[model samples]
Target: MPEPVVVDAMGGDHGPAETVGGAVLARREHGVPVVLVGRAGEIRAELARHGAVDEIDVVHAEEAVPMGERGTGGAASGASSLRVGCELLRQGAGSALVSAGSTGAVVSCAIRGVGRAPAVLRPALAIALPAVTGGATVLIDAGATSDPTPEMVAQFALLGASYARLVLGAADPSVGLLSIGAEPGKGNRLTRRVAELLPLLPLRFHGNVEGHDVLAGAVDVIVTDGFTGNVVLKNVEGAVRAVLTLVARSGTAAPEALREVARRYGPETHGGAVLLGLSGTVVVAHGSSRAATVARACAVAHDLAGGGVAARLRDHLTAEPVN
Candidate 1:
């Protein structure tokens, strides 16, 4: 049997409850192995609530990291469940780690515990969004590093391309630098420099793609700094929700059609973003995730770890010589 996926059971808004419930769902419905790390008593109580006591393993953790912790404070201090879960992953106690904790804390702890892959200046978060062109688009730096240098952004492009091919199965994926305009040298200084460097790398560079190009499938992989990428992600979610509401209110789309569209874009559909460029797999779900989202995250992490995403990315980066 494969090693279990480690979950920070007390890291999210409704953890121990939601996380533990999700673990039960993953085990019962998905047949995936999971180990929950947090306050053992609380986890048992929640599991008992679902009549699932002792069905999953619970690793004890004394403290919990606050959801409001964005900075380096208190995060690095002690044996928090987030850190313990990362340590479990680093020590090979689990195949992957899933957390809906603070994105910054998760990234920082994973980098410190699981470490970065070879030649990775900084780790990035990548997610595939359903596109208008039938397939999906891989968006990198979804919220991992907000102020990476130009060189780091270029590396994010490579990571995104690899993720497209490996996880999303986009054969020979083409990458685009997300920019203000769809022309060369058309973005801020960071994007301009990154645009210059991308073509020099060992991937198919698609020049610059404007905002609309993201969902148009103009390129398989879209790369940008975390700040902009995060904004784009939230904006896309809000825009989709608003558009669906308008369509339903106007009776322009059939009820089933609108339901299918909403299901495709739901957070439960994708589970979460994979923290790319790490030495191991870590899926960071939305902090406000529910049990369904948590279960999906565990399944996603198990599949990614089984596919050796982190090792494959490490080997790819090493062979490509990103310098």
Candidate 2:
């Protein structure tokens, strides 16, 4: 049997009920074993309510990291659910860790607990966005390393390409530097420098791509610094929400075509971002995740772990000489 996914059951905005419910849903829908890490009593109560008390395991954690706490450097806090989840992964009790907690805390804890892959300067968060043409475009450095070095950005490209291949099944993923323009020298110094290093890697370099090209599927992977990638992700999410709201207000009830588009492209449906370059699979779900989103996240975590994402990343990175 595959190892279970460890979940920070108290990490989301909706509280333990939703988180636990999601875990149950994931087990039912995808047959993914999950170990809920949080206050045992609370988690048990929640599980009992769903009549799933015997279906999942519970590990006690006394506290949860707040959304504002940053720079913890992955220090293990016995009270923190996120820390406990990472610890479970480190101890080989679970194959992956899933948390809808503070992104910073999850990233920090995963790094400190599971450690980084060989030759990885910093880990990145990779999110797959549904593209207009078909398939998905992966955007890396979603918010992990805000001010990464040029070499770091180059590493992100390779990481993103590997992700596109493993998760999205892109035979030969095309990598593009996210910049102001499609020209080689369009972006700032960091992008320009990274652009020069991309072609030398064992990837299908597509040169520089603009922001619009992200959703247009111009490239399989779009690499950018964490700050810019985060901003772009939020903007795209907001745009999608705004359009859906406008359609609702117009009393059009959203045509089937538009509904299908929204369903495919929505962030909730994609589960959450995967933290690449870590020793184990770590999925950081949105803080506002509810039962459905949480379940989706668990499914993603299971797939990533079972698919050998970390090993593949390590092998690929180790084979390439760091610039």
Candidate 3:
């Protein structure tokens, strides 16, 4: 059997109960083994509540890092659950890692724990969204950096393209620059410069794609600075919730029917932004994630492990010549 996926069971907004429940669900429903890292006793209690205490193993992490807290490098010093989780992967004790904690902490810990591929200066977060064009599209640097350079954006394109092909099975992914307008000269300096660099990348660079193109799935991969990516992601999420609410209040459609529509809208799609360029799979889900979301995140982790995403990305990055 393969190694289990490591989960920071005490790090999310809902704490060990939801996190542990999700791990149990992933193990039972998905046939994926998960190692819950956190306070062993609390984890056992939560597992016992779901009557799945025996189904999963607990790796004790005496310290728990709460969501929204600053990293140790800055204002405070606290034990990061993300660090412990990533260490498990580095030690070969886990296949992949999943945590619905602080995104900053997760990225920092993963970079420190597993280290980045030599070619990547900073790891990025990429997410795949179900698009209107039947298939899915990927957006990168979703809250990983407030500012990213053209070089970083170029690297994100490569990573996103590789992931699109490897995980999503897109034969040849179309890379696009996420900008304000579809016109070549419409975006800011960073985007325009990045667009200029696109021609040098290995993938097919389809020039400047607009906001609508993201939902329309006009391109396979969309690269942007983290600030813009985060805004887009949050806005889309809010829009989805608003639509669901409107549908709920309209009474024209039954709750079941509305939910079914949402389901088809790909709401059940879970898993957080995946940190690219790490030597192992590390997923950072939202802090407020529920049990089902956590379970889905674990499933995503399983997918990455099965797909050999880490090794493939490492090979792709390392293949480039040093400057």
Candidate 4:
């Protein structure tokens, strides 16, 4: 069994209810311990509601950091639930940390509190997105850096490749540079440069792949700048939602069957994303996550923790450099 995962119970939009409920569900179903970090009273109350008050543990933090709250310089004060959650990972008291806080704040506090793995300059977020192949593909820098350099994209490819190998268990995870077209020279200078550089990496680089390639399962890993990656992710999510809606109204199936169809398109279907390139496990859940989604995030965190993802990533990175 892995160590407990620290949940930032106050970070998401729904606060203690959904966050704490998720923790309870994770502990009950997955048997992973959860340290709920937030206002102690509210967390305790939520836990009691789930009849898990005695089963789980609560760590008290004086304040709750809301979504959109800036890190270090905003109206919010210093020392947040995210900070405490990261500290749990740093101290080895927790195997990983899950939060739905501001992405920027989580990234900032994670870098400052947990620190980066050796040779990892910036931490990247890697997500497993549903594809047309009936499986998921890894898209890195989903929302981490806004303007990542080609070298950074290369680094993302490396990390993403490792994730596909270890987490997804791919033999030779084919890496793709997310571009406008499949041609080597297509896309912006950064994409072309990254496409040119990725093959020299230790992992198997599949050359340039386009957006449709993301779902086509043409490649296992897709690497791009956070700005472009975020945009593509949002658009894909919207498209999935629309498809699910149509499926529900299609009259070809019962509501329960339609729900299964919707489940296939759910954003939470892949759980939370791991913040790669960091020294420890850090999972970030969607802000609107329900209990099951949060529980799934916890299970993913447990997988990374038990697998030693961060250490393997560090070793992989130290062995290579941007070409």
Candidate 3 per-residue lDDT, tens place, 1-323, comes to: 88898999877889997999889889988888899998888989999999887788888877877676555562123445566777788777888889887777777677667755446656678888778767788888776766877887888888788778865789999998999888888899999899888886678999998877877888888888889987887777778778989878887878888776565444214235788766567887777789888888888787777776445544443444321
> If ranked by TM-score, best first, what sequence of candidates would result?
2, 4, 1, 3
How far does residue 317 in candidate 4 sit from its true spot (Å)?
3.7
Location of the lowest summed lDDT over 10 successive residues in candidate 1: 314-323
> Which segments of candidate 1 are over 4 A away from where they belong?
48-55, 68-72, 102-105, 130-135, 147-151, 165-169, 188-193, 200-203, 234-271, 318-323
Which has the greatest TM-score? 2
Writing each residue's lDDT as its tens digit, candidate 4 over 84-135 gives 7888777778878888776667766786678565566567878888777876
TM-score for candidate 4, residues paired by index: 0.78
Q: Could you tally the backbone clashes for each prediction?
A: 0, 1, 0, 0
What is the total number of backbone clashes in candidate 4? 0
Using lDDT as the measure, name the better of candidate 1 and candidate 3.
Answer: 1
lDDT of 3 at 6: 94
lDDT of 2 by residue, 43-81 (tens): 999999999999899999888776566637433566688
Q: Any residue pairs clashing in model 1, and if so which?
A: none
- What is the C-alpha local distance difference test score of candidate 1? 0.82
Name the lDDT value of residue 116 in candidate 1. Answer: 64
| lDDT for residue 85 in candidate 4, whole number 0-100 | 81
> Could you estimate the TM-score for every candidate?
0.76, 0.78, 0.74, 0.78
Q: List the residue pairs that clash in candidate 3.
A: none
Winning model by lDDT: 1
